[model samples]
Target: MRRRLAALLCCLLCLTGCATLAPPYETPAPASSSHWPAGAAYPTLADNAGPLAMHLPLGQVFPDQRLQQLLSLAIANNRDLRQAVIAIEQSRAQFQIEGAALLPQVDAEAQGYRERRPADLSGTGQSRITSEYRAGLGVSAYELDLFGRIRSLRDQALQTYLATEEARRAVHIGLVAEVASAWLTLAADQEHLRLARETLTSQEASYRLIQSRYDAGISSALDLHQAQTSVDNARIDIARYSRLVAQDQNALTLLVGSAIPANLLPEGLQDIRIAISEPAIGLPSQVLLQRPDILQAEHQLRAAYANIGAARAAFFPSIHLLGSFGSASAELTDLFQAGSLAWSFTPQISVPIFDAQRNRLRLRVAETERDLLLARYDKAIQTAFREVADALAAFGTLDTQLQAQRSLVDATANSYNLSQARYQQGIDSYLNVLDSQRALYRAQQELISTELGRQLNRTSLYRALGGGWYTSEPS
Candidate 1:
């Protein structure tokens, strides 16, 4: 038995021959960028010791617990995230199947059959009945991964699984950002509505005062007409903002996968505040490694690398060990008897002697694909870094712009109030009062929009930095 084993090993070794495979992988370096956008030009906050692009610590960035709960629900119930999870499970199953290729497979087999044969040309006196029965334990086809084909495939599967995991994380981040953005829009719209109502109330009061003066034979008909026009215009905006707020609320509900509880939406815009600590992006390349998209891209590159290794390994021969042990007999009662026992062992080798260069072409194709993935990875990193910087700069500059807009709104409001009083007292013309009210209304609307813009920029920065969504903080 030892000699036979030794001979079988020799035959296996002879069939495999020798082949060289690629070495282990090393993470490629991230590319660098030089210039970034300016916050002064854009509506962004100044760095103020923080970088234009900052990596926020991941531990619970969402300040509000209610919003966090909504995000959690979205992660669990969102349709897109569920699909990504299913994809991960499929990759895991494929990994398991590929992993099993490196090990031998054993199975037990049992069968029984009956057949009748005619006595052709009187070779037998009469028709004969035959019965066959067999039972055995057998080793089925299994590949010996000498050149690491199966191992490479398993590794590829692992990378694919990781990629899917990152995809889910990315989706999670997106959902959180979307929910936050929608909430901000709702808040902004509500604030705009409030401002519109206030403006309308003030205009209505002015219209009544102007009509009283006109009835008292003090003010002109044009003054009452202008006052009525201002009130009507303000009323229109109130309706618009009210509609926008409701639309935004319904959209937020859809994103959250259920009706937004009364407690979920903040009472008013002032009650809803976005807490963003400005981040300083160290270097462009670092941003790529931190961004989930770039990480996913890197994983794809690794999967492609593993595929190339697998294709290269296909150039070599494959070895399989086969074994069978069974008992068989014409009589069913003796099918398992010692005298009916049989056993056989075979080691097979398959080499790609001639296949019209198919294997070589596959290797070539894999190489090209790996190269494509590498380039894509590099480009993705660059893009992520750019986006982070852009978002940071925008948020910083917008902070300053928001301040200016607030000041404008305040100054215009006071000016409008003084003008209305003067015009009622016959100290100024009605046209002057109309102009002031127009300016005040425009400023109020601009302030609301700028505030919303700032909040949106904050959300963009968080998404760009790949912040939040994960349970643990960023390393």
Candidate 2:
């Protein structure tokens, strides 16, 4: 008994001694900031003139509660996001399962049998063998993680789970941006439709007036024809805007995961308000941490770090402990007898004696993979910064454009009014009036389009800033 005890102790010490020699795990150096790609010459986010603080409730008033509700529903029920949620759950379960490997497992076994013995069976007598049920708890092949292999694997699984969560967040950020962009388009299209309707109304009135003047021989046929053409063109625009609205509606329906009722559309342009309030763009360095894609990339890099450690460990010897305990007996009643006890333990060590350089190749591969992930992470950060800069630059330039456009529209409208008055008094030819009106209409449309673009760009900036989406999902 002492000898057996001494043997078991020696086996344990052998494994423990090997455990002391575990390969040193070193985390790869973080991606260098110098490696981050250089973006364009756009102004730094800190120097940008947008709002310096990220405020909730952007204060761009959309009077349409229905649009807000639709946005909420889409966030909740969107198919892509739902699928992402399922993926997170799956990853969570997998991590948990892999983690369970670090702990021992216990189980119970039971058996009952009845057999008729034939002559010469069991050394001879013809007898009936019956066995009552017996049950006992057993442990089989429980491997002790003496070298932290299972722990490292569990850590890898954990990092993967976190990466999946970030992936889901990234999806959410994308989905919200999509919804906001679609909503902005819908709003702008509605505005365009409104302008088209107004223009059509004015053109129809002008056409009627010109037709009366022509019949009364007060104006030339050319004037009548020009007025009719304006009306026809206005009608064409109305149809085009109508089609655009329909398309936007379809897109919103798909985004929201359900059809939007007709009554749900905003009644007028005033009812559709875009939040023009700018959020604060923090320092460029902070922006790197804010972007979900960057965060996801970082998590991937971390997982790769853990993988390198695991691979390096493989270069050292591996120890496995395999053992099982059970009870058996030739006779039914003797199944639980002391003599029935059986157990075996095997302590194994497999050193890399020869593998034709396969182990070295694997280690090299792991190291290379780590480097690739590091590069990718660095690139992601740089890209994220560039997007923020781009969005901010567009926002700045578009703001100036929209302001200038509004001024031009005002000037054109005034000029058109003066020309129309002068022509009615016979001080200017009808051609001058037509020219003024056309310019005014074009300017008006352009201004509206530009304003809409400004809002859209603002939305893009918010997305690039990572907005409030980082905490959108629970940890």
Candidate 3:
């Protein structure tokens, strides 16, 4: 009997290794074109021409030592990113819990019990007391996965965990890009403030000269008023830029999650040049697959597929084993004696016959979820393609815009100087001088703004190409 029982257990173990019912997984092709848009602006290289573009480390991406230091602090202390890391850990634990269910769970237990029986029920004239002691190692309701249900559930959990990991990577990339942009913005605002202050000083000097000429009866009241107006405008700009600089600092502080060091903060655009080299953009098909968000979406789709497998398996019979090997006796001291040795094996089989169509509904739900994830996966790819295209378009043109803006600044400066000289010699009206001054001021401001935009475009392109995270150092 013992040998037969052992053989039966072995057979059951062999039978428990069932084939998965999950549909074969195939990555759906994106509906968009295989290559990036073609144009002189949209450059492409042969797929095998060289290695795909590599992501630059944060240190290399932000060559400014101060920006690099701030990025490090943000990555370590940012609350949102810290929470994302914790979420990954939680998902990993949950996956392990689900995976453990695929195998038997053995537990050691000890117990003591006492019971009393009424005389009438005992068939004796008096009440009777009974005492029992038990100690054992047991398997309680361990499901033998003959239909792959447990296996499928485990796979689903694993994929979900992997998706969460990808999400964390996405967060890391976003944080790095945001910090770089914020630092650059603060620097630009500081430069704007400095320019306003200098312009105000120059305007005040001109106002003083025109006021003296008016007092000497050599200049009209209109000349004095116009010069004063220029001074006033410059003063107003000073105040506005001061406020903006403060606000930019506050924004950077918030992103860093702590007070930034004064030395680490940007003083001007020139001081914090975003001089990172542009990364090579590879073929769209090759690059899009590596985007963290797209990978996360694909993992979710795989998880949904696994859920469908589990649902399909639910339609078949399930077998569970509940058994215990132990000793039981009225006296605790004799619990392990020869006669006290005892064992029990209970195998339960459950066949689905009628459950109000619950199994069918579950299968339908899984299928619907899979379809939803499939749509989301495709959307992720499409969105990435659009972002890359837009960034590339901006990058191809911003340098030209910057170049034109610098020329405009130079031309306006020359016009201002010539107009001032003509006004002093009584060859032109003060209005022309004022007009020239205004034009020069506007052109200078635009040049600063354009320079900042050019730098920011590089950052955006790096992020759009998914080059900021997962390749090296954290930030």
Candidate 4:
């Protein structure tokens, strides 16, 4: 009888291994345009065709050795990214735990017990003592998974683990982008501070000349006050930019997760040049699918789909096997004696008959969750598409804007110089010199701001294109 039962159990296990109730998985079609939007804002195929044939690492993307080192440090030490990596490990463990249910769990067991029985209960006039000893290997309540309930649950966990891994990659990518931006910002602010100091020195010298003229009765009080106003404005800007530079340093330190070395810190814009090599954008819709966040969303959708499978399997009969092969003896000395060999097998079948609509409700919930994640996946792709498009638009025009700003600064500087010369020769009023100086200062500030924008836009474009996360491979 036992031999027949063992053969039957083996056959059932073999059959169960081939069953899966989970719906077939197919990647959902993207709900967006196939190609990038056409305009001057986007790079022409010829322009992007060369050099951009592959994805580049962050080190290659930034080109600046200092920025690359900082990126490495941030990836290693950033707390948020560290937590994300830890989360992936946690998810992996959970997946292992869930997947283990698909197989039988065998455990070795040994037990000894002594019991004293009351006289009446033992059916004797005196109390009696009994001892029992047993040792064996046994399989506990291991689900057979005949309907693939356990398999589906394991699949869901596996997908969830994969999603977590993608999420970690996403965090890593964002951390690199943030660290680069912070370094760039510090560089820009330092440049601004230096410019402000230089302007202040020049304005102070003009103020001293005006004061001397006023004392000699050659210049009016209005002229002296106006010159002092320029000096005061420069001083105010110096103080403001000084604070900004310090704040930028602090921000970079926070992103770096430790005090940065003075040498690695950006001293000025010129010190931190971000020369990112362009990456292949491929088809716009296809590129979105490659983005970490979008991939994570799709993994979540797949998990939900697996959940629906598990829920559907819940409506079928579940088979569980609990068996043991061991020896039992009343005396410890005979626990493993020749006559003590014994074994038992027990299989249980549970069929859901009436669960008050609970199973149906669970299936409904799982289906709804799948639908929700499907929508989220589509939205993630859309959001990624928009970010790339916006970055491209900014990238295409920022160079032109920077060029115009530089030309304006040059023209304003020349105008200021000519106006100051005219005033010294009494060819123009002091008011004209003051006006020109103000215009020159404003134009210089704008030029610095535009230059910062141009550099920042480059970083944005690199990030939007999902560069720095992986090495380029032949597509």
Candidate 5:
């Protein structure tokens, strides 16, 4: 009889987790075009058509030694990224915790007891004493996943863990982009500061020339004051750009999570202008799927599906088994001796006969959550499409704009020189020189801005295409 019962238990164990009621999951179709949008906004690229960002790591993207070193520091020290990594570990442990539920939980225990009773309370009508001791090995209430409830839970945890890992990758990509962006901004601002100081020095010299002319009656008070005003304006700008450069440095330091070395600070944006090269963008919308944010969304949707399976199993009966084997004796010395063997086996089946529709509601909640995640997954893809398109639009026209701006600076510089020579030859008023100088300075500033814009847009395109995503997953 015992052998037959043991065989029956073995068959039950084999039959456990044989079924799942969860609906099959299907990846949602993206509501976007197969190819990049084409128009004046999305111009053709002369770049050699090749791979996307998967082959473009950070080392290739920035190429600047100082920027590369800064990126390394940020990756090693950024608190936000550290937290994301810690969250991946947390999720991994949670997955393992849930997985352990699929097996029996064995426990070992030991106990001792002593008691004395008065004669009035004793059935023997005399004072009595008793001593008892017990020791055992047991399987706690281990749920048999006949309907895949435990398996579904484990699946849900695994997917969630994977999603967390993807989230960490997303953080990493964003951090690299942010550090590079900040560094570029600092370089641009520093260039602006240097230009302002140079302008101040030139204007100071011009002021002295105008003062000497006024003393000799060769210039009017109006001319003298105007020259002084130009000098003051340069001074104001120098101060303003100085403040901006300092602020940019502070922001970059914050992103790096440590003080940046003096040598690593960018001297000018020119050095980094060609550092970030745009890829050929030869791939299709499928490339967007590789983005960490989108992958994280897909994993979360999968976890929601697993949750639905677990909820569905809640409507069926669940079986829990508790068993133990041990030896107990009244004497401590004989606790583990023969003839003192103790054992027990309990099989519990909890049928969900009725619970005021609790199980139905739980299943509904799980299904609704799945629907929510599916919608999110679809939105993530659409958002990615828009970001890439916007970056492309800016990238398409930025080079033309930069060339036009450089031409403008050259034209203004020629005009400024001619105006200054005419004023010295007494053929034109000082106003013309002042106006030309102002125009030339503004044009130069615009050229710097345009160059900076081109570089930043290149970085944006790289990020939108999910650069810096390749990394080691948790082992």
Candidate 6:
């Protein structure tokens, strides 16, 4: 019995040299251009000599101390990120379960039996009873995997687990960019609020001056009412910007997964800092593959290939081995005696003769899934390529646009000053002063908006470039 059990164990340990029926895996056909889009709109990158794109550290991209702290809090506390991590662990456990199918499950078992028979039935002319006891280790229905069916399933599970890991990384990268964008938006709103309040104060002073002039018969009621209208517009904007700032704060808090401390909040757009680290723009294939989403799709495609292997394997025979070795005796005390040894071995082979085309249908399903995944993988690459191209186009022109907006603001401010002085010297109508003030206010708001767009573009570029971040505060 011991020798038989040893042989069975040896058999399990010798399961090798098997190959799967799955087709060889190759990267699906390219769905997009091999190169990034380049024209007058796209930035001409001088630093394209670097390595293929990778996620720069969050700290290296967003250098603000306050922003870094916020990113850390979001990573640690965000529920979405937590869910992503849990998903990875779940997939890993499933892979482990699939891997265990190829191994024998050996365990101990014991049984007792008692029976009675009439004398006539026993042919002994007297009633008699029989008793037996047995105990030993046994193995039940362990598949030999001669065709790699179980192995293929195990590989499928492993690839799925890896895909889950890539998914988590994708979420992590997105969270960092989201936090940065939210912080910048909040700062921009705060700046807008500050400008509105200052404009309100200036308008109130102008209204009072116009009121004095009207009482002295030097300014018309039209002038006084126009000054009042300007003050009212500033007040309206103050209220609007105040509401926006509050909403921005709420949004940031949700992303952080907790209430924000006052110290970690941004003061204004001017206080936020970002560094554009231009990664080496390379072939579209190299840049797109570095994105976690793209990598995740690729893994999924590979997992589909494994599923096909498993399905094909199902068409072949499957072998299962079962065995038990132990001692048996009519008397309980004799169960383990030297002369009471007993053993049994059973092997099962299942060859699919006819199953209403079930196996063929399954194989078809697996092939279809593989094809679908391949398409999705190709689409993912194409999408990422387009995103990077769009970001590059925006980056090239934003600096010039921002500079022009600044110049417009400066010119408007100078015109407002000149018009105001002329009205006070009684050489110009108050309408000119009002028009200059309105232009100045509009230009200032546009400046703030334009600057915000420039900063937002930087954040978008960081996301498009495919980077990662530490879960903890950057030191």
**lDDT string, candidate 3, 414-458, tens digits:** 999999999999999999999999999999899889989978887
**Ten-residue region with minimum lDDT total, candidate 6:** 466-475
* Candidate 4 vs 6: which has more lDDT: 6
Clashes of each: 12, 3, 0, 0, 0, 1
Weakest lDDT window of 10 consecutive positions for candidate 5: 45-54
Off by over 4 Å in 1: 6-24, 34-60, 121-128, 469-475
Per-residue CA lDDT of model 4 for 61-174, tens digit only, reads 698888888888888889999999999999999999988887889999899999999998888878999999889999999888788888888889999999999999888888
lDDT of 1 by residue, 1-475 (tens): 9598868667654543333364456777776454345535543222232333444443346667766777777777777778878988998898898887766788998889897888774468788888988889888876667787877888888888888888877887888789888888887888888888998998898888889899998989988898899999988998988899889988887887766678778545566556765554444544457677777888888898888888988898887878778888888899877799877788788988999999999998888988899888888877776777677667667878889999998999899889978876789999999999899888978887888888788788778777631122233
lDDT for model 3 comes to: 0.85
**Local accuracy of candidate 6 as per-residue lDDT tens digits, 1-475:** 6688778768755763377767889877668887776788776653343455455566777888889889999999999999999999999999999999877899899999998989988788888898989999899998888888888899899999999999998898889889889999999999999999999999999999899999999999899998999999999999999999999999999999999999999889886667874434556665667788988998898899999998998888888888888888899998988999888889898999999999999999999999899889988888887888888888777788889989999999999999999999999999999999999998989888888888888888777766631111222
Error of 3 at 465 (Å): 1.3
After superposing candidate 2 on the true structure, give the runs of residues whose Cα lies further than 4 Å from its correct spot. Answer: 1-64, 111-135, 261-264, 268-279, 337-340, 469-475
Instruction: Using lDDT as the measure, name the better of candidate 4 and candidate 5.
Output: 5
lDDT of each: 0.76, 0.70, 0.85, 0.83, 0.85, 0.85
lDDT of 2: 0.70
What local lDDT does model 4 show for residue 123?
82
TM values, all candidates: 0.87, 0.81, 0.95, 0.94, 0.94, 0.93
Preferred candidate (lDDT higher): 2 or 4? 4
The TM-score of candidate 3 is 0.95
lDDT of residue 249 for candidate 2? 83
So what's the TM-score on candidate 6? 0.93
State in Å the error of residue 15, model 3.
3.3
- Cα lDDT tens digits, model 5, 254-297, are 88999899999999977675454444564445468888899999
Candidate 2 to truth, TM: 0.81
Query: Hey, what RMSD does candidate 6 come out at?
Result: 3.6
Candidate 6: segments with Cα more than 4 A from true spot = 1-17, 46-55, 117-126, 277-279, 468-475
Ranking by TM-score: 3, 4, 5, 6, 1, 2
